[model samples]
Target: MEANELLRKVRKIDIKTRGLSQNIFAGEYHTAFKGRGMTFSEVREYQYGDDVRDIDWNVTARHNHPYVKVYEEERELTVMLLVDVSRSRLFGAVGEEKREMIAEIAATLAYSAITNNDKIGVIFFSDKIEKFIPPKKGKKHILLIIRELLDFTPENQGTDISVALRYFTDALKKRCTTFLISDFIDTHDFTRQLQIACNRHDVIAIQVYDKRDTSLPDVGLMRMTDLETGASRWINTSSKRTRQAYSKWWYERQQSMSDTFSKCRVDHASIATDEDFAHSLMALFKNRGVR
Candidate 1:
């Protein structure tokens, strides 16, 4: 894309996502993702309902009164977005390409993180680590990230979730709330890495998919290319057997994906290309809050 066009799209996404982060998300994001731990704030007079363990006996003895050490949730946290920028992200038969949806979703998450006074970072992957923006705070940092999300292109075209997850655990020393956004179309098994990462940090999976990806239209023979491998083939989509097989494959794939998440205890939600992503996101946040 041209420089001017990229800037325009980035600005457009910033406006929409920033508004959602501010108005729609509001306290939901904070409530869903609590801090890693709490920090001591100050000492105050012990109240009737205060926890007895918090009583500062030294201060009580010196002042001849019961004083409790006040602590607040350490709101400062780091949010990491592990984004898949593979070839499949360009596929869509609906409102927007998967890539476009991903850019918007990443921007929204980044903006939401900033609203909670947290640091936001991103890892763009395409069978490898395409780029990594170190966690940082401020609107300027978020804008830069949005700009990169709009314009940064990857060198490879394949999908490998394991590579990305491994890099995330190795590079980021501190535990963080991480969002892994992708279509979950990987040939390699990354459940082991995902389980390991979840042990160290809170990880959420946001699977973006298109309705057409699950079925085929009866439009006779159609030529298709494997975006990741660059292989081309012709399929007789009008055949009942072909369509049935494809539909069955999709169902099994979805079930396996759900099982992987359940086995690892990872929170996840799937969003279709034409669906109302805002509602799905709100639901996911609400679910996490209740947990």
Candidate 2:
């Protein structure tokens, strides 16, 4: 993309996602992902209802009066976005491509994190770690992330979610709230990696897909290409049996992915290209906040 065009796209996303962060997700995000622990704020005079365990002996002795330690929730946190930038994300027949939707969602989440005074980082992966932008705060950092989301291309074409998850688990020592954004189209088994990552950090999965991915159009014979492998094949889309089999395959794949997430005890949401992702995201946030 041209520099001017890229800048325009970034500005546009910034405007839309910034509004969402301020108006819709800011409160819910803060409620869903809490800080590490409470820290001491100050000491206050002990009241009749105050817990005896909270009494500050030093302060009470110094002032010759009852005092209790006060504490407040630490609200600062580090958020990571593990994004899949594989060739399959470019396949979309019904609406916006998976890549486009992923970018928008990532930008919205980044804005939401900053609104809560949390640092945000990104791991762009495609069978390998394509890029790593360390966590940072402020609008400048978020704008840079949006720019990269819109323009960054991966060096590899295949998808290996396990590699990305393993890297994430090892790279950050402190527990972080991580969002794994992908289509979940990898053929390799990543359940073990996902389980380990979830055990170490708070991981949420967002699966963005196109309508065509679920079922094929009844347009007679069609040629399909595997974006990642550069393989091509012809299929009879008009045949009822063929269509049914394809749908079944897609459904089974989705069910398996859902099962993996459940086993890992991770929060997740799925959104289609033709659907309003805001509603799905809001549901996920509300659910997590309640928990």
Q: At residue 220, give the lDDT of candidate 2.
A: 89
Model 2, residue 269: distance off in Å is 0.1
258-278, model 2: which lDDT tens digit per residue?
999999998999999888888
Once fitted onto the true fold, the runs of candidate 2 whose alpha carbons sit more than 4 angstroms away are none
Cα deviation in Å at residue 127, candidate 1? 0.8
Output the lDDT of residue 99, model 1.
Answer: 87
Tell me model 2's lDDT, rounded to 2 decimals.
Answer: 0.94
User: Which 10 successive residues of model 1 have the least lDDT summed?
Assistant: 94-103
Candidate 1 per-residue lDDT, tens place, 141-217, comes to 99999998888889999999999999999999898999999999998999999999988999999999989899999
Supply candidate 1's per-residue lDDT for 240.
Answer: 100
TM match of model 1 to true structure: 0.98
